[model samples]
Target: MMPCDSNMTSIVQRIARQALLTFRSPPRIGEEASKSFLENHSKLKSLMTEVRAADLHLVPRRASDSPPAVPVPPPVTYMHICETDQFSMGVFLLKSGASIPLHDHPGMHGMLKVMYGKVRISCFDRLQRSPQAAQPGALRRSVLRSTAEYTEDSDPCVLSPDRDNLHQIDAVDGPTAFMDILAPPYDPDDGRDCHYYRLLTDAEEGEHTEQREQKEKEVWLMEISQPPEFWCGGEPYPGPEVSL
Candidate 1:
């Protein structure tokens, strides 16, 4: 077993325990059980906090020498870790230059901890539509919303229902790895699914109201056609087997 196996086992143990607690009675996430259920799960939350890029033994390597641990622009890759009706955990490894496109998790909660190299996570908040919606033509790109970036050392991003749901992740400078956990694993029937998006750029420089000072530095993404450059290729899960 590798040194990483130790951390994997420890983290899995905590997740499994949380799974059991969640099973006894699905913890209501509102203000009611905020302390007992959510706060008490501080232990598991720390697992993500404790992990760092160096812990996974991730080192920069040329993509041509070996198969990408995750999806490349050519093929999508994913490794199975473990899954239960309540939640699922897995790891995604990206080769240098490869990226997981901007995507959304409709009705789930997730935590991502970097285990290998650095990653740039751009998060976005989705805007609500008014009851008296405007015509499609009137809904210009400017009306959509905000974006932010996160690193391994950054705080965990919270996505509720459909708010702040779309984002893209890119391995920075080199190959990278991150552990991911999604509760009530994506189910299309439940209206929880993943959808990809690309940044909406200002096509006509002076055509639209420009907010260069506020907008140039800020990433305003528009849902455009998916690019062929983004794709994931699968690799082996390097962690200990997780069982709950």
Candidate 2:
């Protein structure tokens, strides 16, 4: 096990403190951040890529093989590491064949780094809404950004308010675990809330406005209730203690 409050802070501890300083005064959406802020963000990204499951003392929590009569638990679990007003850090564990459904992080910046196993992540960017866009109850226009698999050795998947902000993650082949960092954690009162969605076919978009470019297809994503099949349980973080 890693030591806590030692003379030298572990990578996880440093990540927590750096995240605090990096997001304390984040740049406004749609604006370019200052040089110093960008520099700090770059450093943070580097640190995140360096983290491993061993550093956090994490291992995949798989569904039991002998489960005929056993009451199966939720497929996902969250291990809370630490948090501050500016940021929150945690790990999400997914059992084999489990998935975290498509969701949006409203007005936030985030990073996802696989700590173990592998995950296929599909990312999307919400397009600007027009006057003739779908009504309040209809789907929102989004553009598929990318879909890729990542392992512990991969670079972190980064998301910002306006770029690749909505995504779905699925465990590949077996159980998976990843570290998640979100700035200015979701606060419904502050108008920052999480919303779930599912991709709809182009025909379902039903848009009467401009057509999507043939090169880059635009699709619709309908807001949905959190998928009933998925839920997140909790676990204790067994890594070095993080303080900010």
Candidate 3:
């Protein structure tokens, strides 16, 4: 299909519609309908392959461009596409060597599909009710779930409230960008606020460290305020408008 086919709504728009149908009425949407929506999500991934940077009005920087003399701003930026009570969708662009540090989605579910370039994502899962007192503050034990790399040709990375919900994303080699969707979006009043975390290691080094022999590596995490070095600057979404 032609990119931005004027005769039809874009695939992103179709995905938005399906997402709305899937999430708008959670209690009443039924199990079978929910399953169907997941199938739609898979189809959305397949359709994503047809998308190009130009389709989103993004112009990739050429390699020969001279580096700026002044200090450069943060290398990561975001484009707000659309949002509703059910879900929010957007794109994140990261320059070479940039990373979205280890953080969490609280109780949200998410899907991320790379649009261009590549990213390495490290994901973690919090152990249940495992908070303990530490010198600086409270720390919770967690398990390193997976570390995987993704490119435009890869499947979407999926996350749920209880699984692979905490992750760090880093751009590999050169620039990268990905489309992200979060369900029931982040609302502090609703207990879905985003939180940042740092992994902690025991200095004493005992049985806990030896447990690394197990399948999942366990570690402590300390909650903290957003890092001063990282911030997202928003840009207008330039693709076909989505309406739910």
Candidate 4:
């Protein structure tokens, strides 16, 4: 069932409050409080019905519905909800087969909750390199931390400053939309900027390589400009106004 829209406190408000509690103090916040905030964030599906197709301009397709000859929807779009000193909250919509490429949010914490359809997320972590081996402007070593698929029924995918900080998101089967929150929002002037990366693997490896070996493999990531293929258009939020 959809949540009632008449509530005095909107979901965005609740999210903002939780974000403040989670990020207000970086050096002094207690572990228990941080865990509690994440737990609350994971259980926030009930608060954000606006991200679903029924609330947006997109129509839900039935199984019998014929596929359109031309899919004119933008490949990707964003709906900016709100932002403060503590966090930024928004929604991203992806057309079928569209993807948000591998990227890193420097010194940021994030949560992603699917409001409709499913997405495959591949996450990675930067590994420390030996000082002697580290070269200026050379590719960095990273490990594939995890790769998983998420649907509306699943809990939000979480990331911190160190863990799962670099990842890619791909829409599966059909159009997908997800609510995203980032703490201490990106500020290029403050050295918190989004950087794009691509994973480098050994091309000589056989295609029949073992899955376990693939997971254990260490890869290098090369920083690059944003791919020309991926760009985000903006759409106005069609939900209740949030004040913060």
Winner on lDDT between 1 and 3 is 3
Error of 3 at 62 (Å): 4.9
TM accuracy, model 4: 0.75
The better-scoring model by TM-score among 1 and 4 is: 4
Best by lDDT: 2
lDDT of 2 by residue, 162-239 (tens): 789999999998889999999889998887777888888656655532465555656778878888999988889999
Q: Which digits, one per residue and each the tens of the lDDT, describe model 1 over residues 49-129? A: 775543443343455656635443443356667787777777777777677887767555667777656777766655443
Global local distance difference test of model 4:
0.72
What would the per-residue lDDT of candidate 4 be over residues 70-122, giving only the tens digit for each residue?
45545788889888887898889887888999998777778887878889999
Question: lDDT, candidate 2, residue 8?
Answer: 71
Q: Each model's C-alpha lDDT?
A: 0.58, 0.85, 0.75, 0.72
Candidates in order, TM-scores: namely 0.69, 0.89, 0.80, 0.75
| Cα lDDT over the full model 3 | 0.75
Inter-residue clash pairs, candidate 2: none
Decoy 2 TM-score against native? 0.89
At residue 100, give the lDDT of candidate 1. Answer: 86
